[model samples]
Target: GQQVMQIPQYQHVQEGEDFTTYCNSSTTLSNIQWYKQRPGGHPVFLIQLVKSGEVKKQKRLTFQFGEAKKNSSLHITATQTTDVGTYFCMFSGGYNKLIFGAGTRLAVHP
Candidate 1:
């Protein structure tokens, strides 16, 4: 069995502060996907990281994958209330099985 471990189960940040979440997998991943779930809403796909040592940015958000392809991180700079949500890292196993991290819940205060 494979597992993905996510750190900082919960995060509280001031409006304009930075926040980050880390994910590590027991096995090397072919690709990893990030998701965001707003309060009372279902998870929505944010981005996917496929290459080793890859980095991608979307506005104030940045994503990185380890060279070993066993770890990943998401960082949000200048956090805003709009960024308040739960972030999840996921990977697909064979046979269409998808495994998700425990998720990091973020709270932003203005």
Candidate 2:
């Protein structure tokens, strides 16, 4: 199926919680893009890094570009229920058809 599924498909946390998800790809990817999908909102591009050994952070989130570029990672600190949504990572290929990783769902409590 060429899909990567993360463990604990679902996660629930209190107002201040710690959450994490892992993604592994079948093949090497050129570029990795991360998107956040709100309950009723569309996928919005958060950030994109093309260079190897690249790292970027926004507020409470951290992103890393693997040295091999075949994999990547994202981490969040002090998660809030407001962070509820599915996060997807898209891999680029020859046909331009993006291969998306099974989304990681995060639910926070208040």
Candidate 3:
């Protein structure tokens, strides 16, 4: 079975520090999607890329689409309590059954 593994499952960081999350898949993917969820809120769309070797960034965050589309990574330059949230990456090709990567939950210390 195809599956993605995320490291640290969760992280706790102090303000003004750096944080990172990694996503890896057992099989190649067609496209990957990232999302963020607040403490008590639903996930909000952050970014999505389908092309191979695609990369995107927003402020202190960087996203990468693996050349094989089987893996991806996310990096944050600095950590802030406001950055507290869960990040998820999904890989799917079918119309009805969208496979998703394991999510990484980040926690920032104040």
The C-alpha TM-scores of every prediction are 0.98, 0.85, 0.90
lDDT accuracy of residue 66 in candidate 3: 85
Question: So what's the TM-score on candidate 1?
Answer: 0.98
Off by over 4 Å in 1: none
Q: C-alpha displacement of 29 in model 2, angstroms? A: 1.3
Which runs in model 2 stand beyond 4 Å of their true positions?
1-8
Better of 1 and 2 by TM-score: 1
**Candidates sorted by TM-score, best first:** 1, 3, 2
lDDT for model 2 comes to 0.76
lDDT (0-100) at residue 34 of candidate 2?
88
Model 2: per-residue Cα lDDT over 1-110, one tens digit each: 45554445677877666776656666666778888899999988988868877889999988887787767777778898778998877777657677777778788888
**Where does candidate 3 stray beyond 4 Å?**
none
**C-alpha displacement of 107 in model 3, angstroms?**
1.0
Instruction: Provide the overall lDDT of each model, using Cα atoms, as 2-decimal numbers.
Output: 0.97, 0.76, 0.82
Please write out the lDDT profile of model 1 over residues 1-110, one tens digit for every residue.
Answer: 98999999999999999999999987899999999999999999999999999999999999999999999999999999999999999998766999999999999999
